[model samples]
Target chain A: MKHTISVLVENHSGVLSRITGLFSRRGFNIESLAVGPTQDPEVSRITIIADGDEHTVEQIEKQLNKLIEVIKVRTLTKDECFARELMLVKVSCPAEKRSEIMTIAEMTEAKIVDVTLTTVTLEICARYQKLERFIEIVAPYGITELVRTGTIAIQKGSETMDRKK
Target chain B: MKMKACQAMVECLKAENIKVVFGYPGAAICPFYDALMDSGIKHVLVRHEANAGHEASGMARMTGKPAVCVVTSGPGAVNLITAIATAYADSIPIVCITGQVNTDQIGSDVFQEADITGAAEPFVKHSYLVKDPNDIPRVFKEAFYIAGSGRPGPVLIDMPMDVQKAEIDFEYPKKADIRSYKPTLKGNAFQVKRVMAELEKAKKPLICIGGGVFAANAQDEVVKLSHTMNIPVITTMMGISVFSDDDPLFFGMLGSHGVPAANRAVNECDVLFLVGARVGDRAVRTPLALEQTTKILHIDIDPAELGKNIRVDFPLVGDAKNVLTQLLERAKPMQHDEWLAQLESWRVERKFATAKKGTVVPRQFIDKLSRRLPDNTVVVADVGQNQIWTATSFHIGEGGRFMTSGGMGTMGYSLPAAIGAKIADPKRPVIAICGDGSLQMCMMELATAVQNDVRVKLVVMTNKRLGMVRELQTKGYNGRETAVFLDGSPDFIKLAEAYGIRSCRVTDDRSADEAISLLAEYDGIALVEVIVDENEATL
Candidate 1:
């Protein structure tokens, strides 16, 4: 089962190491993790996608909450979250295949960020499954390089994980 | 007027009311040592860095305050890893400060540079790597606050050499308000009432105590609740000394090495209210027995501990003292004379096995010592057979303390930890009970005891082997003993004398009384080495 966990932590050096160290130590398989500055400068939000059963995911949530730097932790079900992953892929493209590659990029609503004589770099920000399908379509053209920003997520509604006084 | 970062650190220690520091000095920590010279904080220079960590833990356990340990980076910091983890496992609040290489040279593989914070991340409650001098006061304050609060544990602050040298206007924070680190101190009224409602109807109720009871200073409340509700009380190994053994409702430790009566009570109880215990594997050797017999209501300060180990029917997240107090208020007096009588019968009928002649039995020796020691004495037991023996047999009186490496199960913890306990409270007698193999691990701390004039009695159970492991090997491998014998171990009495402490050796049960008296009557540091049969097992 796939679960998305959102962790709010104090913006301190080595805090990330502490959280990731816990995941590895507890043998939790993390599929992807994205951390970025939040509205509060002193706090950072980490979105982690992990593969585990319900018990394992609950253990991870409880363990993550035990960290002193961690302020709050929430396991966002698919229904209550807006999740996305951004990927930049540089695919091998010849002059003749450029139009076909461009059409595929357009169909997926991806942007052509850079282009060279033999390569076309495209950036796509979409849901996890959509990005996976897009990558599958481009793989035939030969993807020379790719980088993913992991997954970032937010609660869809007014439910806020703000630090309660 | 600028001050050195080390000076600021010393001043912050003073502000935190840290009068004693257990530490060792080295190149990276030179500046801090220099500043400590005139800082008025007494420094007990331990022989090994690991001893410093245990001593600090011992002091913290005794005083209910965060103890401090300072060491240099690299091997010095590495040496304290075991001790730090020991404190973390038992939730002993200790503030560990390590000096690092200069900030610019940190990643350059400079001399004496190691990522101490990274190494200690998993075990420590929190860690800091201070890059700026201005963060010194805040870091120290936060370190102490975090260590001493919310299921207390060890915290580390890695001070870079340059940061400790930088000058800044220092102002220690009056209070630590870490916005996100608030711990729930009071139990929710709804939950408290719910527990009370259940307790009112419970027939065979039992209260299982753990280290958190002592950590929260709720021993009195635990005793009061047990008496008021006439509920039986059993403790985890770390929860020793929380309840007096003489109490009618008190059962001994409940776990793998626990008495049959305590384990039986755990299996027979109807409502098991666990206060401040995590129900670890050692404590719940047969979880199936507990699950089948009782519905567990776990009250703990840390939410992470609620459902981490076992199934909890009800959880009241609050400080043990506060929650226990609330339970006492709403709870009505009850009588379970039938249940109490059943437990008492089991306690009387199940007697531990006695030792054969020619062997100085560990349990018999501990029983005698328990009878002879003062009511306020503190017993620090090292790991292995001696620890289990003491836990099962030794009786702690009111106001007495019993400490051990319950979580990490670190050997060589007794001598240094006893020294720390004695230093924290000189008015009380402190004893360190260790096995021969365990004693050899950190016997160097005998020098620290002598140098500081720390009057702690060192009792080495000289079994000539790692008795516990040897017993396991004997049982599991069909009596094949491997690597369990200590053939070249030094005589502990001679070792104590080498450190300028009085010493004696006892070989029989007849002489055990005299040895106990000598240890009790002596006014300064002393050691009593008891030679026991190597074949005798802990159980």
Candidate 2:
């Protein structure tokens, strides 16, 4: 099963490397990982999408909690949390196909970020499923380049994951 | 007032109440060594960096405090990796300080430089690389805190040469505030009640003690619980000395090398309460047997250990001492006379035979040594056949301690570890029991012992071969022994004499008793080499 785990860790050098090293050493397959500064500047939130069974996921959570820098860990349930991914894709589009690409982007609510003579770049930010659909629709035009920011997640309601001390 | 970072490092150690250090120095760590000279901390210069780690680990195991080891960059630090891993496996607290190349040379592949922190990441509880001198005090404080805290393990601090040279105002923190690292000390009230309920209903309850019981200093609590409830207690190799062998409720060790009686009891138990034990492969050799017969209630400090290797029925995540204390409070005094009698019958049925008269038996030697040593003696056993012999035969009396590389099974741990244990408390008698193969791995430490006047009795069980591996081949591979025999092993007595240490060699049954007397009477470092039959089976 694929699970999204939210890990809040102290903002310190080498912590990311330590975490990634753990995943690799344990042979846990990491599907996607996105890290960014949290609401507290001194802390960072890492969202990791990993594939594992029940036991493996439990081990991952326990191991993360063991790390000194890590503050909190939560495996976000699908209903209780909202997740989003951002992608910037450049697709090959000639002048004749530019209008058609723009129509598709409009349908997906993706914004045009840049346009060149032979390529059109679109930026899309949505739930994972929506982003996947948008990419699939754009694939017909021939994707020249693609970059994803992975996924960032938060609880659906007002429950905040904060450090106790 | 400002001082060099290296000086501040020494001062920080003093503030942490560290009295001794085991280490090997090199060019990268010269600055720290220079500062150590005036720091007033007793430094035992180890023969090898790996020995330094083992020595520190021994001290930590004996004293229940974080031991310190210092090494230089590259190979110096690399050599300590195995020791660090061993400490991690056994949950022994050790602080390993390694000197690095200058800050500018860090990532440039300069001379004698290596990524010590990177190499140690998997094993260490926590690690730090100091880039600034001002962070020295904080880093040391955090290192000590992390290493000695709950589920204790090794922690490393890699200090760059430039950082050690730079001057800074040293201010050691009174406490480390690691918000994410709070270890649960008390067991949950509801969980304690649940365990009590289980105890009340259990007909044939067994308590399986692991190394965590010793780590939590809950030996007394566990003993009391076992005696009050009339429960049979079996130990993993790591938990060997947690309960005395003579205790009526205490059964022998459990697992692959375990006594047949203990394994049979575990296979028959209705409810097995595992306190501070991980129930690893060695301890639970036949998991299916346990799963089919017993309902396991695992009490451990680390949540990760619960249901890790086996499915735990009742999980209590708390310090062993606290959880055991709570269980004792809520537990009702009960007796299982029938169950106890059945266990006793099993024990009597599978008792080992007495040693034959002609040859020097390893089990007989251990039994003789156990009787000769004082009640408080600390026995450090190296890995291999010697370990199994000592584990099965050595009777640890009250106040006695046994230290070994149970988890990692590292060879060459006993001698230096004995030195460390003796150094920790000079009043207690310490012994290092090693096989010929194991002793040769770190025999140079005899020089360190002589130089420091550390009185650790060293016993070498000489079989002229790697007995354990040879036994494995004999049993599993149709007796085709290869690369197991030591064709030309050195004369250990001469080697000890060359190091200026007193030594003796024992052959035949009569000389073995004489060797024991010599070990008992010796005041400083001494070695006793006992010749044993090479084909003696361990299991």
- Give per-model TM-scores: 0.96, 0.95
- CAPRI verdict (incorrect, acceptable, medium, high) for model 1: medium
Model 2 alpha-carbon drift over 4 Å, by segment? A94-99, A115-118, A163-165, B348-359
User: For every candidate, what is the interface RMSD in angstroms?
Assistant: 1.2, 0.6
> Model 2, A16: alpha-carbon shift in Å?
0.6
Q: Which ten residues in a row have the lowest lDDT in candidate 2 chain B?
A: B349-358
Clashing pairs in 1: none
Q: Model 1: number of clashes?
A: 0
Predicted candidate 1 versus true structure: per-residue lDDT over A1-165, tens digit per residue: 999999999998788988899999999999999999999899899999999998788899888888878999999899988999999999999999999999998899999999999999999999899999999999999999999999999887677777332
What TM-score results for chain B in every one of the models?
Answer: 0.98, 0.97
- Scored by Cα lDDT, where does model 1 land? 0.90
Q: How much is the lDDT of residue B162 in candidate 2? A: 88
Q: For model 2 chain A, give the 10-residue run with minimal summed lDDT.
A: A156-165
lDDT by residue for model 1 (B160-276), tens:
888888888988999988876888999999989988888777888889999999899999998998888888999999999987777777889988888888888888888999999
